[model samples]
Target: MPSHETTPAESVWDYPRPPALQRDPRRIVVECAGQILADTTGALKIMETSHPPVFYVPPGDVRTDLLRASSHHTWCEWKGRADFWDILVGSDIRALAAWSYSDPRPPYEDLVGHFAFYAGRVDRCTVDGYTVRPQEGDFYGGWITPEVRGPFKGGTHTHGW
Candidate 1:
């Protein structure tokens, strides 16, 4: 018999949240050492992928000044070129903790320049001061906004983490 530890939970695709639940959105505020880098509105439900919830910010609402283009680049099958950034706080730096698409595929153009940062690398993370704990998949800090809720994987499930 397979050990319980080895048995993975059903893939998220196999356990889809209800339509109403899936539609619910969360807002994410990403900060580095101390300054607010991105205050993204109309962000959708945080999904746990091989990485993290990715905090899909609508392109128009994101603050671009917080980002400085870097030499980093990674590829995404669905999105396209993912450009990276080093988040700057005062004079301190967290290397490659943030990334976004400058020119995404047609389907994802709305997210252009809307970046996502790894929550674990940052000094402080707060979703409206709720103090998010790191999720199982990746380094992400999240705030479950009014539209987002229920059976969230990273909330109480990852308390000690």
Candidate 2:
């Protein structure tokens, strides 16, 4: 478990809108195609209302050499534009498995150069040794930890949420 956890489990409903970014000390390890995609104890989490926290690993901690920039892009009202990456491993190419805000908007600039992977796309993702459940649906990338309470965004009929 992460020693930095100072409070009880958090309810996503209590997370603020526009989101909040805070440094996290928990060990985060992600695996994909039987490879260690990323490993870090220094991570950041983006918390938003109705959503579990999204963990972002610093670019330096990720296996960037195994990732390629893809043409896919997305826009977020809070984080601005994000670019996707495809994971290339041993004759296998996983498309759009990771994303980063190469140039995030103000307030979210700290996320620039950091990468967040889709838990469902990767073989597995663990926080403090606990495997995470990917946020429902394909549109979001929140990692559902036991410490998070959610009526989370994503899944069917949550488009306007």
Candidate 3:
């Protein structure tokens, strides 16, 4: 059984099933290879049931020069197809560390062209000074923050969730 020892702010279980995008004004930062890859207050967060919120940063806030398009793509029934990117900082390379929905489907169209990074693959991902924990599965890029409590659904035993 998953512990429900969550903060008083929000519960992941209460999130919606189809997911909803909301503008998050919190400061979001991504750092890797001793460099700041992205920093922004204008981020969009996707909230869904049994999953931590995923923050999407605007392209203008990211260091685009450090990213190279990878030959990776994935489909999401709600958001549409996503394109991956390899983060190249100096000589260090993190393959498929980031992704974007270039042309999202309805309701999620605001995510088009915005980027979301994998907290596990990056040196650090912080929101409002809280370090984020990456969603357990390699395929999901949700970022778990302190204010959200979860019996999140990405780990080994959560397959059926």
lDDT against the true structure, per candidate, is 0.54, 0.92, 0.92
Model 3 misses residue 4 by how many Å? 18
Quick one: ranking by TM-score, best first?
Answer: 2, 3, 1
Please report, as a residue range, the 10-residue window in candidate 2 with the lowest summed lDDT. 1-10
Taking the candidates one at a time, how many backbone clashes does each contain? 1, 0, 0
TM-score-superior candidate, 1 or 3: 3
Clash list (residue pairs), candidate 1: 119-139
Candidate 3 lDDT tens digits, 1-161: 22334546688899997998999998999999999999999999999998899999999999999999999999988899999999999899999999999999999999988999999999999987788899999988899887788889899899898
User: Cα lDDT of model 2 overall?
Assistant: 0.92
Give a tens-digit lDDT track for model 2, residues 1-161. Answer: 54536648899999999899999998999999999999999999999999888999999999999999999999999899989999999898989999999889989889989999999999999999889999998877999997898788898988897
Better of 1 and 2 by lDDT: 2
Candidate 1 residue lDDT tens string, 1-161: 21234333433333332211122233456666567666654664435432233465555655556556789788766667988877666588788777777797755666666656666766644454444554444333433322233344554455453
Question: How close to the true structure is residue 98 of candidate 1, measured as C-alpha lDDT?
Answer: 70
What lDDT is reached at residue 18 by model 2? 86
